[model samples]
Target: MRRIAMVTLAAGVLITTFSLTTTPADAAVGFWRTVGLSGVDAFGFYDTQAAKVTLTFDLKDTKKDGYSAALRFTFTGTKKQKDDVRVVALTGDRLQDKWQTVTSTRLKHMYVQECRGTWKKSKFTIKKCGAWRRHY
Candidate 1:
């Protein structure tokens, strides 16, 4: 009886571990873009389960030209009604990788625009923007 109970416990633990690591069928989808310009890359995913958008930027400019990266998220509701724009920016060292998240719910259509900009007087002025791409 003791051996049977131990075996049963081990089986239970194995099943639980596998289940925890398994990804759900509705797992979030990811997107990535790489700009030919020196040191500009952005990528991330929208997690429907968490109702959040994650944006990551890997920026590096050898000249340290005050270059910054940003993500413009446009969310629309079920009726395709435009909601609002959420902008997340990353700035600091010339070579830096950072990510930011915005919690958005009830989104039917989601679009993201990756932008490269400069910092001027504690403000980020977008110099250029990639075409707005649909994420969801």
Candidate 2:
């Protein structure tokens, strides 16, 4: 009985260790849009392993004519126990209806970050923004 218990405990420990090591880092996703305007919408996501940001913008209400939207991503993280950051900018044109792009960067230490997205349109003067915080 003692030997059997020891073997079972050892097996459990090995399984747990393997599971932890094999687990994939969590991906962060967020959404944003112009507050008063329903026509412009955007989605953004962060991949922990790839350390990339993907942004997609849609010109939902196509009733009007040509318009252009600009998106900016602000990322904040820590590296070497100190502050680190990276910023990327992407633009989407309404003529095509939808636009998406991805950019690569180091997400810093702790696998945690705060990302904020700001969006504006050519015809629309005021800028709109949204934020998401991800932890792993």
Candidate 3:
């Protein structure tokens, strides 16, 4: 009886450890649009039909440092449609890249990023501009 109980406890412990290791991470970043400026409208319009946005994630290494991930977005024109494509990139510590850690995790991929960057058009740069985020 003692041996059976010990084995059962061991199995339970192993199962718990395996479950924790297999659990996914959190990739819930938000997205938004950069509106109002000259190129803003263009980007917005392009956003309406279809546009390509690149996302780079800078994460921490397994040593609890920092790294990155990326994704491409193809927006289909419609009223509040959801984008289903996903991509990611990783850099920094090979033994422990946060990119992969969060890759399996899900994210909120579409929202408007607050303005700090600018919009660049032909011979012009729209200052005080913002970019959009992805909604997953």
Whole-structure CA lDDT of model 3 = 0.34
Clashing pairs in 2: none
- lDDT tens readout by residue for model 2, 1-136: 9999999999999999999867365665555443333334444444445554444444333323333333334444545433333333333433334555544454542222222233455223324333433332
lDDT score for residue 111 of model 2: 25
How large an RMSD does model 1 have? 3.6
Better of 1 and 3 by lDDT: 1
- The collision pairs in model 1 are none
RMSD each, Å: 3.6, 8.8, 15.1
- Put down candidate 1 lDDT per residue, 19-95, tens digits, no spaces: 99876775665565544444456666556655544444443333356667666778777665558787666765375
TM-score rank, highest first? 1, 2, 3
* lDDT (10s digit) by residue, model 3, range 1-136: 9999999999999999998866244222333333343222112211111233334333321222222222234333345555454333233224333322222111223343322121233222212434455343
Worst 10 residues of 1 by lDDT: 54-63
Model 2 clashes, total count = 0
Q: Among these predicted structures, which one has the highest TM-score?
A: 1
What's model 2's lDDT at 96?
33
